[model samples]
Target: MTVNVLVPSSLSREAEDKREATRKLGYVARAATIFRADRLIVYPDRDGETGRFDDGFVSTVLRYAATPPYLRNEAWGMRDELEYVGVLPPLRAVSQTGSESNGSGSTRQGIVTEVGPEGRVRVNCGLQHPISLNTPPSMEVAEGERVTVRISSRRPVRAKLVDGPLPGLSVERTDLSTALGREDAGVCIASSRHGAELTVGRLETLAGRVDRDGMTVAFGAPERGLPEILGIEASDVVAAYDAADVDDRVDVEPTDLGFDLWLNTVPNQGSKVVRTEEALFATLAPLSLQE
Candidate 1:
């Protein structure tokens, strides 16, 4: 099943400096990686953005953090947004492609260094040197494109171009409406302090649904909750959940933006405000539990 995590483009508006902003985004990336999220979407929140770090800054740092260490230099090169990237933490996420190895071989993320004749391409898969491999007849690739390579033997580097998604999380930028309307967007949930308080029974039911259909969770930036970002009053969110509780209906429309549920994942939160990165861990932990 697919798990999509969404964060506002103003995610780092509360950071004190670029270093802090980049570091904060690093933890967000770490959260997505830890949860095995298929997509890390940055939805536009232009009105909520502040300071120097805008949507572009947020997306660039997130994309850079998601890149594998072996291919980072070649893939991203240099950019001003990554000036404080060294402060970012490392995300040692495992490669999903190797789950079905079964002794056949291991899969590694590779970058296409060059395209050659006869449908061949030179790929750098973190070996001592780039290797030339014939691209599959059905597949077409270009230089600088990331691909997956299955390595059978490292001694002679016996490997072949494989059709599969790259390891780890991928970053994307889009508007909230488009994200929620995706075909794979099973259950769309908005995280907010003014929403329904999560209970044991509710979690059990939500887990079952998430396991069966998948989930797309959206989070707001610091100092700006979903109610504020979406222009919906906090009272409306509370009333919607209150109404849902009266009747056993899950199809409550708190807002016209198409979110199935507005959830207060951290009920009775001690702090006055929970950072977006912190909320990611608190929220996804329970939702990711499988039976």
Candidate 2:
């Protein structure tokens, strides 16, 4: 099943400086990678965004964090591609294709540019040239689709389209409504302190839905929770999210947009507040659990 995690553009709004902001975003990226999220979307929270946090800074840092160390220079060589300058931890992505055999080959994320006759497809696998590779008889690919291509050799361009996960998570910057409305967005969940407390039984049921239809989990920015970001009061959020019951979609419209569920992933907290990164791990832990 596909899993998408959403973080607000003001994710680092609570940071005191750029160094702290970059560090905070690094943890967010780590959480997404650890959860095996297919996509990490940066939704706009313009009103809640602080002056220190730039509009596209969050996405830029995340994109940088997701890139492999070796490929970062090649993929993000341009000056504009580099955003935050703080040190970032390495995200050693686990390749779906088995481990490299003596370093002769490596897995690379690619985009399909053209699907030609006789199962030949042109793919841009970060190489100097977009190479044409043959697809497996059972596999079907379309132009403009992102894919994982295993390149055994670069000189002669020997590669094949393999069935596996992308080397690293992909990043996207978009608005909340637009992201949730995507065709593959599946079940969209909003996490907030004012939402219903997630119990064991409720989590088990939710996990089933996530496995079946895939899932998109959205997180709020620092200090400002989703309720505030969406211009909904905390009291109304509690009433709307809780009273909506266990229906596939929450009927009460807390904000202009709708979500399948508004969940309080952290229930009885000793601390008065739970940070976004903490919430991400706490929320995804039970939700991503296997039966």
Candidate 3:
């Protein structure tokens, strides 16, 4: 008999041991439903068995559901007993393509000849440089240099050229950029209070992942987009329902992200405030899943 095992989802993505282990559990059917298990307000079995698990012997067990933090529901919420998923990716910039024959195709390649803070770049291309052409960087060029550029065509009089300025032929400019170093870098914001502080920075990841725009930050632990990282819901923490309390995600924004966390009940009573710049690492230091 293949008995169905309904594991608590609160620890699914939180505790590392459970995250991987839960993923391995092949659920025949998966979903959350409110039922009666020991009169507990948990996502019990189809029969509302919240605790009584009977394989051979009867025993009591806790059940947690997968409620994302951002989800809004009364009760059915927890502070720290949450499961986690991977971090979300950054948003990509939208762009279009067009060419004389149709599209720029793969016929364009550029080197960063010059650049500025706001993603402005002066590039040298393979548009037949050092020939009867135009260079945008306004720098000196050598003969027979490989360059290509988007030329201005009007009056049916096409001006054919490489890329660099000829002995005397002048060129035009375009706002087109070659490469924007990293949009996920140099973003700075902070939130603080009394003496505790936290700051969120938009920077590059070692794996070359872009998180500038979609990069979430927090002042308090729960603010760093905890609902996104942890599968805890507002409904979980409310006494009207039953759920375990959980911790805040490390990178959450500590402002008014909302929570019944230890902080909210303790040092951070009745406050949805924000401000920061102190030993953030100290507050976030001991929070590792190493144990």
Candidate 4:
């Protein structure tokens, strides 16, 4: 199933400095990686953005974080937003063969270094050297584009460019409504403390639905919850959830954000506020369970 994870551009609003902000986004990346999210979308929250770290900074760091370590230097040469990228945590996502394999071979993320004659391209995919591969008959690729390479063996470096989804996370920037309206956006959920408390019974039902339909989960900024970011009242979210509990068919028109559910993954908390990164772990831990 496709799992899409969305976070606001102002996710680092509570961070004190660039280092702290970069570090904070690291955990967000970590959460997505751990949960095997297909996409990491950064939705705009201009009003909540603060300091020098805006949407561009957030997207840049996230994209950089998602890049494989070996290709990072060539993928993103030098950028102002990555000045403090040293503080970002290592994702160590499974990008190569060994534990993870596909069919007869293994799929890995690769960057096209050069496009040669006869529809062949040289790709750098963490191999000893860049390997020349023929582009798939139906696919067209250009230099600097990222592609997936299926490797059958590494001793002689036998690999081929295949039209397949890249392993690990992919970063993109878009508005919230557009993300929620995507065809693969399954059961869209908005995370908020003021929403319905996720009970065991509710989780079981939610899990089943998510497993069948896939899911697109959206999160807010550090201090700004979904209600504030979406320009809705917290009470309205609570009321919508309460109404849904009574009747599952009840449409949550009060929020008008198009989310199927406004969920409080962490019901009772000891802290006054839960950081967005922390909330990711708490929320995804249960939602990503396999049946």
TM-scores, in order shown? Answer: 0.92, 0.77, 0.17, 0.93
Q: Model 3: what TM-score? A: 0.17
Q: What is candidate 2's lDDT per residue for 67-185, written digit by digit as tens?
A: 65544554565654255544665666664223551135677777777889998988876667888888887677888666777778766767888877666788999888888887777
Lowest lDDT block of 10, candidate 3: 32-41
Pick by TM-score: 1 or 4, better one: 4
Q: What is the model-wide C-alpha lDDT for candidate 1?
A: 0.86
Error of 3 at 274 (Å): 39
Which 10 consecutive residues of model 4 have the lowest summed lDDT? 246-255
Query: Per-residue lDDT for 248 in model 1?
Result: 47
Once fitted onto the true fold, the runs of candidate 3 whose alpha carbons sit more than 4 angstroms away are 1-131, 134-137, 143-148, 154-291
Q: Using alpha carbons, what is the TM-score of model 1?
A: 0.92
Model 3: how far residue 270 lies from native, Å: 44
Residue-pair clashes per candidate: 0, 0, 45, 0
Q: What is candidate 1's CA lDDT for residue 9?
A: 93
Candidate 3 C-alpha lDDT tens digits along 1-291: 001111212212221353442332211011111111111111111221222221111111122122111111222233332232222111110111234322332222233344443333343442333113343444444332323344344333233333442211111111111111123211112122322212232111200121222211122221322232224453332321112112233232222222212121123535463211121222222211121
lDDT of 1 by residue, 178-243 (tens): 999999998788888887888887777677678878999999988889889989888888766665
Per-model RMSD to reference: 2.5, 5.7, 23.7, 2.3
Off-target runs (Cα >4 Å) in candidate 1 are: 96-105, 243-257
